[model samples]
Structure formats: structure tokens, C-alpha cells
Target: MDTVIVSSQYQIVIPQEIRESMGIVSGQKIQMIAYRNRIELIPLKPIAQMRGFLKGIETEVVREGDRV
Candidate 1:
């Protein structure tokens, strides 16, 4: 795990390696969530970029006779 130090202003810069790997760029919006005891950052992707992300996934599901 990469360790980061929070500045006096309570701001921490994401590491270069992690940013490059995750395609994070300057001015890109990221969501911060406080879950349990840790903080999570989620990248907000555009709708166009999210298209076809689940292509070719399994679609079959068991159903009851009445439901079918």
C-alpha cells in the first residue's frame, strides 16, 4: 500500500504511480466517501464512457412458472 502525508491544509496529493494507473487527471472530479473508519475516493465517469462496460455478461436466470 502507498502511504501519503496530509499537508497542513488537510489536503493530500495522490501518488503519481497510482494516478497514472487509474487514469486520474487534473481537474477531474472524484467523490469522497467516509465508510466505516476509512475514506474512499470514487471517480465520476461520464455516461458515454460507461457504455458497454457489461457487454457479454451472463443473462440467464431461474424463474418460477408463474413469473415466467
Candidate 2:
């Protein structure tokens, strides 16, 4: 485990080991998710990384109306 110190402005540098292992380059976008007492960081890749993900797929969530 690595220990990181948060600066006065509340910013911490990610460890070199984790960054290199995860291939986290500069200008990479990250998504922050908060669940209960834990926080998750998900890396968001470029649009090119999402090619062929939605071929002939239904992009809708069918909902029933007039529920009791």
C-alpha cells in the first residue's frame, strides 16, 4: 500500500507505480462515483475506444405507464 499526502488545496498526486501500472497518462479523464462510504474512480477513454459498442443495439429502457 502507498501513502499519499493531500496538499493544502486538497489535491494529491497519484503514485507513480499505480499510474504506470494502470497506464494513466496525462490529460486522461476520470469519473468519480460515490457509493455509501467509498468512492470510486473510473477512467474514461477516448471515443475511439468505444467503437463498435452499440451496433444494432436498442438504446432505450422500456417503462410501463399507469402503474398502480
lDDT of 1: 0.93
lDDT of 2 by residue, 16-63 (tens): 999888888988998889999976778888899899988999887777
List all candidate RMSDs to the true structure: 1.3, 5.2
Candidate 2 yields a Cα-based lDDT of: 0.86
The best candidate by lDDT is 1
Model 1 vs truth, CA RMSD: 1.3
Q: Which prediction has the highest TM-score against the true structure? A: 1
Clashes of 1: 0
List model 1 lDDT by residue over 1-68, tens digit each.
Answer: 99999999999999999999989999988999999999999878888999999999999999998995
lDDT of each: 0.93, 0.86
